[model samples]
Target: MDNGSFALMQQLEQLYIDHHSWLSSLLRRKLSNSSDAADLAHDVYLNLIRKGGVPSAENCRRHLTQIAKGMVIDLYRRRRLEAIHLEALREQPEPLVPSEEVRALAVEALSHVDAALRNQPSKARQALLMHKLSGMGHRDIAAELKVSVSSVEKYIASGLRACTPYAVKRRPFR
Candidate 1:
């Protein structure tokens, strides 16, 4: 490794030593789940490592906290989506309920879609959700989003393109 990369790694190690517990504690208080707190604490550092820089000492805690907060929000959003999916599944006929693997795959696919399009325009995300989940046509989605029908079509298409990289091939569920 180059000298700069080595120095950054060492700095990150020291930062982890200094801030990991504090980060975990902050997340635990916010999330009220120790396990998830620990997991997200690790994720925070991993994110830093991937970003390839250490924040200055004064800003380190703030940077870590921001990342942790975003992660916490994602965790809550994911749980909410999963709960909604579960409720819908529960309403289905027992015989029609999917296998556990199928259910897991469905949830994983939803997560991929969410993670992929999260940073896209809100109209895009909303249009796609309305079309797929609410079974609304483009005209209704355009009316709801207060955009032109063509704009709604573009939004849905953009959202789909964003998620294309994350798509997995489907297998027959049976």
Candidate 2:
């Protein structure tokens, strides 16, 4: 590795050594589950590595806290979605349910979609959901939202753009 990469790795190693336990303890308190806390602590490091930042010693705790907080929120959202999906399945009259693998994939996709929509404006997210989930046309969405067709189109486009990164990342290799 080059000088910069070496330095970054060294910094990350030190940061992990210094803060992993503290972070894990914090997460344990917040999540009240040791396994989940450990997993999230590892995830926080992975996120930091992916971000390629060598956080300063003085600010590292705060930075790590922010990243961990976001991860915790994401974890909660995923669990909530899973609970809802299970409840819906239970409500169905038929004994049939999706296979475990299929359900896992669906939940993963739903989580990505939920994350993508989290940053969007309410109207934009609603328009996108109406178009994609409800199978509404642009004009129909506009009517429902009390906006023009052009506005609805823009909102859908924006939401799609936000979600495009996740879709692209998951595409199969040729």
Q: Which candidate gets the maximum TM-score versus the true structure?
A: 1
Write down the lDDT that model 1 would get: 0.90
> Which 10 residues in a row give candidate 1 its minimum summed lDDT?
165-174
Collision count for each candidate, in order: 0, 0
For 121-158, candidate 2 gives per-residue lDDT tens digits of 99999999999989999999999999999999899999
Candidate 2 runs further than 4 Å off: 118-152, 161-174
Cα lDDT, all candidates: 0.90, 0.90
Candidate 1 residues lying further than 4 Å off, grouped into runs, are 119-155, 165-174
- Looking at model 1, residue 92 earns an lDDT score of 99
lDDT of 1 by residue, 63-119 (tens): 998988888889889999899988999999999898898889888987987898787
Q: Please report the TM-score between candidate 2 and the true structure.
A: 0.73
